[model samples]
Target: MHSLNRLARIAAVLYLLIAVIGPFSIIYVPSTLVVAGDAAATTSNLAASTGLFQAGLVGYLIIFLAEIVLTVILFDLFKAVDHTLSMTAMAARLAMTIIHGLNLLSLFVVSLLASGAAYLSVFDPAQLDALVLLLFNAHDLGYTIGIVFLSLHVMVLGYLVYQSGFLPQVLGILLVLAGLGYVIDSAGLLFFDSYLTTPFYVAIPIAIAEVAFPLWLLIKGVKEEALPKAAPQPA
Candidate 1:
């Protein structure tokens, strides 16, 4: 059980790193460079930017693998602890695992589609136009589905955290906030485009909390004393 917990913690860390750092490095850094007027002076600079995208793709794949491992470890963790909180937590984690898996798979497909569109664009502009439209529709659908699942998953996690004495209340609060962000973003994309601005910022801190709390719980085994127990029946 202890070993499983350790593995869970390790997997969480890896997932978090790949999810957060990879995307930030790949997208944020180069874009910042361009915006700051620090971009390279030649066409090569634009071409080189694709390297960051490739790196991010690699990182995303690694995150996908880590998520799968984390799911298994969480299942083991669920079996190790016998308590109401643990059971609820297990359900929440399982739900999130399934949703996240689907999201990752969708992301993989979207990435491939986008890459294909970009490659085809070089040879035929008309083909690129059709591909772009198809990609856009696919992306919108994928985003909608992913956000819906993720919002539910985050809410479940928040509920589990609130019930589990082993987990910090602040983490639960953050999870709730994150879930709210997803909800808002989804609605915004469906209705108004301006609503998305705040979610990006909200997501950053929430991601940190997600990684920190899970890692803490997995490493320390819920502090034993903090574990919840069944209440005594009236006699």
Candidate 2:
């Protein structure tokens, strides 16, 4: 029980770290570097801020590595509740992690095209610029696919947490809502052309759930008394 409490705190710290690093790479960098529909401008921005682009990729790599560790820990933390469902949650998160790792290659391609390497000199400037936009578009699509798996993971995780006596059930409900939000946003991103330009109000639940969960874990840890008692051995 003490070990579980310690593990919960560790998970909370890691989760909070990912939350901090994620926005810089996923939101701020793109908002700064990408100019929708203007391939040349976007390319130029990447070229001018090569350091920032590289840093963002590095941030993503950190996030990817951290998530791998966090996923394993979370699986261990929750598996006692319902092993099958916990395994499903872990597998779903692993799938999302794999997709995200592969998706980073697209960003690397954009970086290479923008670097003006001798080999890339063969391609005309216009072609390279267009490639940058295309690569970013591909990355965006990959991200949407990854989010689908993440939503599944969260939904299953919510169920497990809700069932587990040690954790608060309200946290589970919020997580379920957050999972729904991700699913809806991913679908909108896939089907709606205007989705990107519109407000992302649906994401509020996700932010709330994520923040609340980690804070609870950090502050309260798990309720040791609520843990299931072990059965006595037969004589």
Candidate 3:
């Protein structure tokens, strides 16, 4: 039981690390460097901030590696509740992580295009700029697809948490809502041309649920009394 609680805390720490590290690549770098509908300008920005762009790539890699470890820890923590469901959740999260890691290749292509290398000399500056923008858009689409898988993971993990008895039920409910929000937003991004133009309140549940869950894990760990007892060994 004590070991389980300790594992929960370790998971919490890793979750917190991901939360802190993710936004630098996902939010900060893009907003800092990408210009909407201006391919030349965006490429110029990338060239000017090569160090920052590289840092963003490193940040993404760190998050990807962390997610791999986190997936295993979570599966262990929840497997006693329902082994199959825990495995399902772990699988979904792993799928999302793989998608994200592969998606970085697009960004790497963008970086190479921005490098002004001799090998790229065949392409005109205008062509290179357009290619950079296209790769960036492709990366965005891939990220949305990854989010769909993450939604599945969150929803399944939420169900496990609700059934486990060792964790707070409210967190489980919030996670389900958050997962639903992710699904809705991902659908919008994939299907609707005007999705980004419209105002959306889906972020509220996502923010609250993600933030609260990790904080709870860090502070409360798990309820000792509610943990499942190990089966007795043969005498």
The reply for model 1, stretches above 4 Å from the true place, is: 3-8, 25-50, 75-123, 133-137, 199-208, 211-221, 228-235
lDDT of 3 by residue, 1-235 (tens): 3388888888999999999989899989988888989999999899899999999999999999999999999988887788778889999999999999999999998888887789999999899999998998999999999999999999998898898899989999999988998999999999998888323578988888899988898898898678775433334
Sort the candidates on lDDT, descending order.
Answer: 3, 2, 1
Candidate 3 TM-score over all chains jointly = 0.95
Better of 2 and 3 by lDDT: 3
TM-score ranking of the models: 3, 2, 1
**Model 2 residue 1 lDDT?**
42
How many Å off is the CA of 38 in candidate 1? 23
Estimate candidate 3's alpha-carbon lDDT, on a 0 to 1 scale: 0.90
Question: Per-model C-alpha lDDT, please?
Answer: 0.54, 0.88, 0.90
Tens digit of per-residue lDDT, candidate 2, span 101-216: 99999999887787678999889989999999999989989988999999999999888789889999999999998999889889889899878742456778898899999999
Prediction 1 global C-alpha lDDT = 0.54
Q: Return the TM-score for candidate 2, rounded to 2 decimals.
A: 0.94
Quick one: best lDDT, which candidate? 3
